[model samples]
Target: MYVLAVLSVLHLCCSSPATSQDWPLDCTARKTIPYHSDNGRLFREDDVWNYTTVILREDLGLIVLGTRGVIYALDINNINTKKASVKWDVTDTQQTECTYKGKDQEIDCQNYIRILHTIEDGRIFVCGTNAFNPMCDYMNYTEGQLILQNDQEDGKGKCPFDPFQRFSSVWVEGELYSATSMNFLGSEPVVMRGSPEPIRTEFKTSWLNEPNFVFMDHIPEGANSPTGDDDKVYLFFSETAVEYDFYHKLAVSRVARVCKGDLGGQRTLQRKWTSFVKARLECPVLESQLPYLVQDVFRLCPDDDWNSCIFYAVFTPQMDSSDYSAVCAYSMHDIQQVFTEGKFKTPVTVETSFVKWVMFSGDLPTPRPGACIDAEAREQGIQSSLDLPDKTLQFIRDRPLMDQAVQPISSRPLLVKKGAWFLRIVVAPVAALDGATYPVMFIGTDSGSVLKAVDYPADNAADTFIIEEVQLFQSSNAIKILRLSESTGHLLVGSEVGIVQMPLSSCGRYKSCADCVLARDPYCAWDLTSGQCTAISSAQTQAKRKLIQNLQDGDTSLCPPSEKAKMINTSFVMGSNVKLKCELISNLAEATWYRGDNQLAPSDKHHISRDSLVIPNAGSDDAGMYTCWSTEGIAGHVHRRQEAEFKLTLGTEDPIAPQARSASKGLVGLQVLVVFLSLMLGILVGWNFYKGHFPLPCMQKQRQSSIEDSQADVPGVLEPLHCTEDKTTAPAGNSNNNHTDLANTVPVDGHATEESSI
Candidate 1:
């Protein structure tokens, strides 16, 4: 237990996040079910045998595997935090016939396993190769054992002990219809079902040479069935269907349908099952590449609205040219016509060959498709066995499941089939990075490394597939399988070493990064005024410009406080230099620097730093309320922040920017003189005749000529004599208007002579 705990901690430490410059910190993985086992421990070490086949039953929610002919059922759904319990184990009862003394040595004789098909109402059926030795009657299971029972109850048919190497079975209503091979090398192909085993079919020629059973699924509505009813089971597999003249060297994928009613009874075994006829599946492209090792089949998804059912398949080739060896597709209504016609009406012939796809789109075909090879051919004879109906020979056609069995990054399309657009995204298998939710594609190479990428769409077909290669997982063993988490969207990557987890959110940050530049995205821009990355909006540019102008104007305190504003402490020593910081609202109309009530002057020491205030040679005068006030038109109101209260005790007798201080005093004197001059100039401009003249306008109007000499002022006041004013009247014009002379005369106030410049 202590060792287990230590190993767990070690595993965590080893899977830590990547440090600087390490790319692909996270990646996807391929794992076996044992990795998710309870206690997280597999069978006692040295158990190297892998599972030959696996079955997932929805009703039981159990994952059952055939390992060395021993059945191990893991109720995966009953997991406590990704930990599964080993529910049941079935051992081989036939192992007693072998001479092996121990449990470990007896495992080799049991091999070549297939999945279980539910027969009739409740019984489950499975079969495997007995290693071709009559002594190897005893097989192995995980928990219990099963004895080989070849002797029939009634002994009606030849109960020859047949060891099926490769086979597939489908259950309709209650009976099981099986296609199986006879020998390990694959010699004959035959169809048989049930104890009464009514249904039987066989073909004479080597029609299904090394044929792989791909799929068996129920047909939905609108399927082109000969009976015109959609209630049928379709079978998909890869076979060699050659005519007498031509070399049908190319792989042929075929589709055959069987009605649910034809599964059982004596008539099925006796009659030559021509009812299991096949036709070439139609594809738009010529020379389509056939998928190799047409292994597993699954129902993708059904769309009742479109009258369509989709299927998916896995193709793992022993020999492939490119990294991409998997293919997925669907069947369209128009393509199904070839099956109904029982022949390829027109094969899209090209230089490249073709094969049929067991799984297309998301749903499986009508019949349970065979995986690896047609079980009927294997059951009849061996790999050399044939299962061709007479009518199928006339077509002598080719079936292609994919294009270019292996596709390079450049040649692959963004979409695969006519209906589904393929996105060439590869998810990396690196630790922590693998489990991310980004839509990624993962490529497991022949070498140990796994490549992860984003399928960024290119502008056209000629352009290469744009892949954001995010990570690479370096392992020493081949990747077995990849499981994507549907909920968190994290990729659970499994390798021979262990499993790795990567969250998708962390991956988006480096989506556009190149292989070399991911570690150092150092070109990050910060606009001080906007307080965000410079690429955000136009406000950033404007704020940046304002910050520059403020610096030029010697206003060093530029950066504004954060929204949840707080004061930060920063200072320099008095002896050397000091910085008094003030944060001004950016783009403000005017900011005042105040030391108590005295306003500050713009100088080198009092100027703005890049975005802060820098003060050199601190002095007492530089102390007190160093505040930044902004009053821009846009602000609608003034804002102030007292950035610092510098109590500078002069460390040095001398001051920096002394000329600036002296110039500022001079400016004050000039300002006072200008104010006085402005007042004098206003009085002079309004005087109309003289610089210092002063008079009350009301008094002047009253003293104007009244036209009567003896007018009003005679009551208790002295009056001037009008006759004395005429004494200096002009002589000749003398005779005229001597009386008017008094009104034109100037008033004298104790002066020697009176003058009227008026």
Candidate 2:
């Protein structure tokens, strides 16, 4: 059983279908829209650092970017031009305050805008790490410029005071729910509600552990819920869990939720969260039994119903030097089940250690301590979360870690990349030829590449394939953010240097039908009417079309049939060089050479390449049918063949001798004289053979006649084994020896005669 399991794993790693990394994707095939300080005029002199955050406002056709000490709004429609941008920078006084805190003036003292949220009434709430002292301001868009609002607010928890600190925030209806360090020294981290009223988690370790936040979003209550069911904000982060007994801190991914309508606890924990609860988010690779650390999460919703939403999280292995990354998906139902049905871990007394932890098995609070206050609870004199009792608030605070971990929808990750660390993920819906909406994932990597892939529902493991891997930046800069613009069909990529906008699909790059089919992209299909590979949406108008696609089975049947071989006959003189041209139409196919039925092996005399065959020093044995076969493997183990055959003939005389004589008169005279001398020489040779002075040339052939008779029925006449022309001429003093040498050089059927003196 162990051997079988090892063999199965080996087969999966070695025999999996090829990914985009195996094929080279042309970067120049797609259009690139770049916006940086070099081209854009809105950038200040020192605004050459990076575009850390990107937010796309589709309705306004704008791309709002956050960088060091500056914020710029770029026109998406005219992103390449300099005049299509507007910028805003922090004041010098704000920079002075940041520098006074002993921060690096060049690096940390600069305003790194980390938060930008779109609030109500076309206004944007912006915040920056103003040299460790975080501050927030409002901006209103006017005639190409963003004017600052006068009301400035404290941005302690909303943005990380240190530029390198990890944080996440989300704005819902005008309030900002954030998870970040609330102090300048970067020690006190908290999850807080920063608007309407200042409510936060307690500063104790039980309430908030040392955490690094990744993402935050709000999930509204269902339409069929009770009257007082409030919307909940979910925060995803990785925190050090204190319940574990290991010497080192164990980092665990967490999913915490808070009710939008929660006021606070009344007495025991006043102005603090009463409904704050968290559960462990488990992302483990089942085959390896290694838990992965959550890096980022994206919420995917098919429609307006938030209940059906699924969270796609990117995770990396918990090794010190790991190269693998995976993408796991969690449904809302599974998350809710773990939070409600799972037990809680509590502290217990132990003599071996100063602190002890164990699973709690006791009665829970009424209506659930972490649950939102419904109409039934309110009717029982519980108006809000503030009315909850001390025992309930203490249980909720002490037991934030669940006994059971929340598992992913699939036992394994949807896709696992071997060499890349995924940083961010975004899904876009693409309409296929079958009229079904398929989700295309655009994942950003830490190596400045964006991988585009499609996940097929029918075959989860085999059908999920990467379509392309695009290098967004020339340098190996990590991709900071990725945002999709459905209106323009472009994906905006943010890196440390600048921002690049690239089209999601580049169907026109694949010029041939086989390439179009082998790509296996859901958005691309070959159009039969226009004879071009085009996007599915553009080809939908065509009356008759063929889509060259099969996600699981790489179907290349849609490619045009290869042309049949046209047989051609050619004759070459002995000791001459010849080249056979095999015109291969498809670049994807492999070309091979064959002589008759057997495959030709590589030799010094015979040369074979992709499209042509060469033979030097033509001989009688080389005068056979030569074939050039073009073959390609598609999908499974199937192979398609295209062939070109040539019938060759070797002769003592040139086949084009008559044409050469007719073209030039000097050539005809020389040929006539040579033929007359050859006849006289033949008569003398026959007289000598009749006289018995010299043995006849046919006499030596009798010894080898038995061996030569077997090849008599062959197509071409066989020549002597040593019938080679010698360029050297003998002197006049040895005329008889020269004549004998010349006679011996003349070849007979399959044998060479010895020289004889007269």
Q: Which structure among the candidates has the greatest lDDT?
A: 2
Q: Which residues of candidate 1, in runs, are more than 4 Å off?
A: 1-48, 57-61, 75-108, 111-113, 117-126, 130-167, 191-195, 220-230, 244-249, 263-269, 281-297, 303-306, 313-328, 332-335, 341-758
lDDT of 1 at 400: 19
Q: After superposition, how far is residue 470 of candidate 1 from its true place, in Å?
A: 12
- Model 2 vs. true fold: TM: 0.72
Give the poorly placed runs of model 2, Cα more than 4 Å off.
1-47, 82-96, 226-228, 459-462, 541-548, 562-758
Q: Write the per-residue lDDT of candidate 2 for residues 1-758, one digit (tens) a residue.
A: 64355334323331243342221111111122232333212222344667777777766767777887667777775455432333445567866877788877778877788888888787888888877788888877677776777577778888898998889999987788899998888779898987667889888887677888998999987356757678899989887877776656667788988888888888876888888888878765435433567888989888867778889888876664446677778998888777767778787767876677677888887767787888878888888887887888888877766777888765556776666688988889777766677878888888777788776664333345666676666547888877788887788777777777777887886676755776668888877667678998777766566666655455766677646678889789887777898865444457788888988876898888877888987888899998888665433434455468899997677544455667777777889999999999999987765442464444334323422343353222224234345445546674443133222333456334333322
Q: Which candidate's TM-score is highest?
A: 2
Error of model 2, residue 466, in angstroms: 0.7
lDDT of 1: 0.36
Give lDDT tens digits, candidate 1, residues 110-177: 44344455444433454444433221122222233333333313111111123323345666655555
- lDDT of each prediction vs. the true structure? 0.36, 0.71
